[model samples]
Target chain A: MQALTNRVKVLDQKPLTFKERLYLPAIFSGMLITFSHLFKKKATINYPEQKRPFSPVFRGLHILNRDEEGRERCTACGLCAVSCPAEAITMESAERQKGEEGLYREEKYAAKYEINMLRCIFCGLCEEACPKDAIYLTETFAPANYSRKSFIYGKPDLLIPDPTKEPEAFAKAQGGIKAHKEKVR
Target chain B: MTNHLNLLPYLSIDFALLFEKLLLIIVVVTGSLVVAMYTTYAERRIAGFLQDRRGPNRAGPFGILQPLADGLKLFMKEDIIPTSSSKWLFIMGPGLAMLTAVMTGAVIPWGSALKIGEKVVSLQIADINIGILFIFGVVSMGVYGIMIGGWASNNKFSLLAAIRGASQIISYELAMGLSLIALLMLTGSLSMKTIVEQQMQGGWGGFLGWNIIYQPLGFLLFLICAFAECNRTPFDLPEAENELNFGYHQEYSSMKLGFYLFAEYINMFISSTVMATLFFGGYDIPFVNEANLANHWGPNIVALLGTVCLLIKSFLFLFVFIWVRWTIPRFRYDQLMDLGWKKMIPLALANMVITGAIVLWLNK
Candidate 1:
């Protein structure tokens, strides 16, 4: 009757002898192990006070890229939205006016690109699928919210305040997209 | 050998004074709570010391603000009620742990009686005729809280752990209770105050008085039982992390979880104090006549100082509990049962018989 659970059942160990059952020595031994760990470096990291170094590949908040001239580079391409498995992305494409060609480098541009923060699985597929190299995910994880609706990251919100925060990253994003666009032209 | 001096006339009469028991009861319970809260802070500091890290320094100056920080954290947390749980029982689980933890201190003689302006006040809450039994009774009832909470959790692991815990505690309590029967026979009184007063203080030709000397085997058995009672390692199978996640409080969160954890440390503190009081002569010291101090400083000051000494001993015992907790490994369920029933019970029985025979031969 007792063996019905799906959980992994450990092997049954033999019982201790009467003297062996005198738990003092064994209990003392176990205490010694914990005491050793008491000297071991604690696994607990004070999250707020001490920030752990994140990996370069660490995907965090999604950002819409800006080109070398500090101009918004997203060209209303629906590729990111279409590729997102979580359906976290939403965008409204608008035609770029005659004077704004340098701003977008495309006739069609994204007027309102919003990613529902709640649905985002942080899968990075949107970043991967963006042909314009307009979207990239940063290593920022500070998006806890009281309401689900507040998580929707629109164009302005998704834009990074400072790509220069990671200089190497800014140059990389700019170089990759500029080359890709020049090749297309 | 030091002649048996009776301090009962002083203690019993002083305790018999009206309103004294009530005050004793209040101080012990409330004082135990304060001590219990601080014990947690001490445990953290010790663990930090062993690890070469300063623990909990963010709360206040050197984290003197830690306990208050903890209290505030608990208070501010969301009090969650599970839809599947028996709301009443869930609420009552930590409540039971807390209640049982504090209640046992009611009869502990923190100090001997001291005389005030016009009256004498005993430093204990109640020195009942069946004091040992009263402690046993209350201590036994504490298990119900865990049982109820675990059962109500609607979790198989909790239920199993609770059953394991309940069985282990019940079996060990028998041995713990029996081990004391020998001590009672020697003392001929159940009142804790009388028992402490009875100890031949280490005066009069190197008196080795505390029951720990007379009953070394009993002390061994009793300490093991105390460890098991507190659900500490290696007897901490009740909330075995490998099997039960976070044990009975697995589903609990926020302040509810805080209450469960806090109540456990409090139980440990109270149990250690009880062990200190029962076997180590409560608050009495060898060669230090509490009565002598009473004569000079008056009874009230004597009682106050004695109470402080008892607290120091209890705190030392509490440190041991924490020390042992970080020292031992948890026992498996079967191993726990085997130790309690097969080993502790028999050893306790044998010790009692040997003690009985020796007393008989000496008297004869």
Candidate 2:
């Protein structure tokens, strides 16, 4: 008990010496130090207008991709669901109807798809697990929301409207994204 | 009542009298505040220049409007009161700080007598007979502001700092008071203006004249004591950040904190003015007394010019205060105490004794 109490740093310690107690010389030294820091380069950045470079491996928002002809390649194989470590992804599979040919790559397609972002740890396991050239994690750093319910994403919230999108979705998709997609195919 | 004397038919309101008093107070208060604000800017800029950095040009061209912006910011900030704090006392803390600050400058002879249009005005607020003692009296009370603020804060860090400060200041005040005793003895008057007069009329040349040459030891003791009194570097334990973060005003926020900070600069300025007045001969142009200048243009002009010269000297002394602050390292708490009591007190005593003996021998 005594040893533990002794280990604690007491606020009231000891008396200063006659000279040390006066404290003028020491104060001057401290001022000199703070004054020195005035001239040193400041470590401030003007953010937002200009952004910093992100690493290649930076995990961000998830996206489902379309091929060159604007056709989704997901087969509703359930491979991504099995590989998702966080159990964040959920899906229901339905067989492609007679007229819905080539709309999905496989005979079966994901009829309902959802990802609970709260549970999705951004580990990219689902991205890696899909054999077909479909799911991907993009390089957007921010996926902020006001509430927990807002975090969970559905197909409409996460998906691109047009498969043959003229504008880029992912910032990296302009160059390496297409190349990486071809390699995956 | 009686078949009485007739009342004056044209008795009038003394608006001019009221106006003069109001104008003087306004001028003095405004001047002190302006000086105090710029003193902070000057301290930062000088320190920056010494360390090779541009200081505070961001606020307004060379930070000319920095103090004004600072004042506006402080005024706009929320006035916070700690839940546990004694509300009245906490509010009183900064009030006392500001009061003591401006009060000390009241006796500073800023400029000489001058006629604007027809009315004569002297730069100082009061020419009190107890000028030096008045300074000491007011300065001794400055610690109370810190003490009250710390106590009202209800914080351990502030309390510790307050205790350190009260004891440290009280200890040094003795040496400071003692050092001045010799100066008072040599001049034989408490009036600051009269002391300057004595320094002038002495048969010895003005070169040999000033109190600095006469009581050199007194000047050393007084200077050191002034440093301790003002809580300058080597003596600034009250606000030592390492041991007690933010010192006595740790709990203070916004303009309350600004009050404490601005008051420190004011004290430094006041002390510098006092030192110049006492030792260097307040506003006395060397070898050319106001009487000589009066030969050229009335006594008022000479006195006015003399006042200007004195102000220049005092302003230069203020720069010296900043210079010393940047150069010296703070002494350890123990070292500070030792320097004050063990060193300054004994030297002050010996200086007094030696000065007295010399005076007696010279008279013989």
Index of the highest-TM-score prediction:
1
Q: Candidate 1 residues B234-332, lDDT tens each?
A: 788888998888777777878778777777887887777777777776776545676676679777776676677777878888877878766666777
DockQ of each candidate, alpha-carbon based:
0.22, 0.08
Best prediction by DockQ: 1
Candidate 1: clashing pairs of residues: A30-B327, A30-B328, A30-B329, A31-B327, A31-B328, A32-B327, B114-B299, B115-B299, B202-B286
Q: Which stretches of candidate 1 lie over 4 Å from their true place?
A: A1-185, B1-22, B200-207
TM-score of 2: 0.65
Docking class of 1: incorrect
Candidate 2 wrongly placed segments (more than 4 Å): A1-185, B1-21, B116-120, B200-208, B286-289, B294-304
Model 2: which docking level applies? incorrect
lDDT (Cα, 0-100) at A114 in candidate 2: 81
